[model samples]
Target: MLINELSKKTGLSIHTIRYYENLGMIKGLADEKVKSNNYKHYNNNTIERLEIIIEAREVGFTLAEIKKILTSWFETTESKPETLELFHAKIKEIDDKMRYFKQTKRLLEKVCEKIQNNE
Candidate 1:
């Protein structure tokens, strides 16, 4: 399908899809038969790649990290253990950040209470 169709199917904006394509996370191919305009067509593989990108980003994976993981996933199966390890590390990082946020929230609440008491 065309880029517009792909965008609708993936629920991603055209600019975002083009951005990913520019970053080499996905690719679109121009049809050889159509010489009137340089329209690029996307296939199922592009959709799958975009889905992977979306899931990874939701879990806090940066684009560079996602690219590495996708490269490994597409190139060979030897990186399965490594990918699992990365995910575990990301989970730990999230846990640590959540604890930090909780502490900060409590501190802010205490400050607010102190200000109200002084008033």
Candidate 2:
């Protein structure tokens, strides 16, 4: 399919897809037979890649980090130590954030209880 279809399927804007392409996170190929325009065609693999990108971003991975993960996981023969290290670090970050989330939730609950008592 084309960029428009890819955008529809992925729920991302054309500009975002082009930006990912520019960042080398995903690629689209232009047809060799067509001589009129330089429209790029995307495949199913591109859809999977975009889905990964979207999920990774939702979990707070930067584009560069996502690129590294995709490259290491898909394009490489062996797992790189740095990639492993990066994942470990991300896990630690998430753990720390989880603690904060629990604290915030508790505080909100206490505030809600106080408000209920006063009313």
Candidate 3:
């Protein structure tokens, strides 16, 4: 399917799909004929990779990190364990950020309440 179809299927915007391609987060279409078109076509495999890439980004993986992971994944299927380890590390990082944000929110709420009460 074309980029538009892939975007619809992936629930990602067309610009974001292009951005991912530009950032090397995912590979472009393999066919030369398809490459001539302004928009690229994608297969099921590409779509699946895009899904994972998008989810990983949502969990705060930078484009550079995503590119590294994708490259390793494509090079060898054995990289699964390493990929999982990376994801676990990212999860821990996100959890730490969440904890900090919650604390900040609590502090802000206290300040707001104090200001409202003029105390």
User: What is the per-residue lDDT of model 1 for residues 1-119, given as tens digits with 9 covering 90 to 100?
Assistant: 99999999999999999999999989899989989998999999889999999999998999988988888888779888888888898899999999999999999999999999995
For residues 1-119, write the lDDT of model 3, one tens digit per residue. Answer: 88888888999998988888887776666566655556556888879789878877787898777876887787678878888888899889989999999999999999999999999
How does each model score on lDDT?
Answer: 0.92, 0.94, 0.82
Query: Which regions of candidate 3 deviate over 4 angstroms?
Result: 30-40
TM-score of each: 0.87, 0.81, 0.72
By the lDDT metric, which is better: model 1 or model 3? 1
Question: Which of the two, 1 or 3, has more TM-score?
Answer: 1
Clashing pairs in 2: none
Residue 60 local lDDT, model 1: 97
Candidate 3 to native Cα RMSD, angstroms: 3.0
| Runs off by more than 4 Å, candidate 1 | none
- Output the worst ten-in-a-row residue range by lDDT, candidate 2: 73-82
What local lDDT does model 3 show for residue 78? 82
Badly placed stretches (over 4 Å) of model 2 are: 104-119
- By lDDT, the better pick of 1 and 2 is 2
